[model samples]
Target: MEFDEERVALYETILDELSPPDGEAVSSAHFEKELELENAYQAIEDLIRLGELEIVNTNCGHVRVRLQKPVPSSTPSTRLEDFSENTVWLAYIVSGSSPRQRRAQRLFQNFEVGEEHLANISHTDSLAQVPGLEDVWCEEVKGLSTEYAILRKEYVFEQADDPWP
Candidate 1:
């Protein structure tokens, strides 16, 4: 399903605030402070389905929630080759188990991975050039057994003029 800009922004915001003490099932009032009822609810549902967020329990008037942080097998360093108002670069680390095959498949499909994707993987000695077809870049760090491979990718974006700038 396609997400509108607001929904995406909301998801990001929620994720950012998803630290340990943030109760799982927050009151509707608290959520309304950060997002409209419909948007907050939808974002929660999406996050839960993605396994990034989970509900622990519901109390008298609140819900307990947990936010799962992404763990990387390797640390990545970012370098800015060139910077301009029109260009931006990024790098990210990614990791998962072999049992997460379905998640990996979904990721590859969404990121436009194809035979060329495998070529990129083969060329890079380190799994750092996994080819992020999306605006985001990620890389693999290490392989855990034969079941899972940790990867990372870098992102380069051609930016546009900032209307506000």
Candidate 2:
């Protein structure tokens, strides 16, 4: 998977809100640990430089940071078209016992053979019918797709051989 700095910043910002409601700051180490990132220091520094985070304090090489902007909580849309106009790919992780199954969200847009970017996602709603869904994440990568119709569960990440000829 490619490193998307903006998405990482958004994820970190959301995590910051998980800190105690007593106005406590979130530590940079927590972000690194939670995300299992190798270059967390650089990532955090980039976010700070981008003004998404502020170094509230530093103790023993660890830094406590604050989100520069307020993050508003959003309820998942019941209707697919109700999603924000920027939603490019709807992603999620399959529910399973493994940590990766529950933690990592694969960009499962379900495009058919020969299909590519700017997809038709009429079949996206069918994912709700499939079992063991951890959660749905709407990703805004530049813009939304063309709402092309396709099947369920297939994704670009997997190099699986298509059974259908």
lDDT of 1 by residue, 1-165 (tens): 125576667667766565433234454345656555456755665545434555666576544555532322122322222333222232222223321132332223223443235334433233232121123333333344322222222222435412111
List the candidates' TM-scores in order. Answer: 0.36, 0.33
Q: How do the residues 1-165 of candidate 2 rate in per-residue lDDT, one tens digit apiece?
A: 113655565445544554322235677687678856566666555444333456779897778876543332332321221223222333332221221222222243343221232123222333221111112222222224322121223212224322111
Q: Which stretches of candidate 1 lie over 4 Å from their true place?
A: 20-29, 33-38, 59-62, 70-165
Best by lDDT: 1
Deviation (Å) of 143 in candidate 2 = 33
Instruction: Give the Cα lDDT of each candidate.
Output: 0.39, 0.38
- What ranges in model 2 sit over 4 Å off? 1-23, 73-165
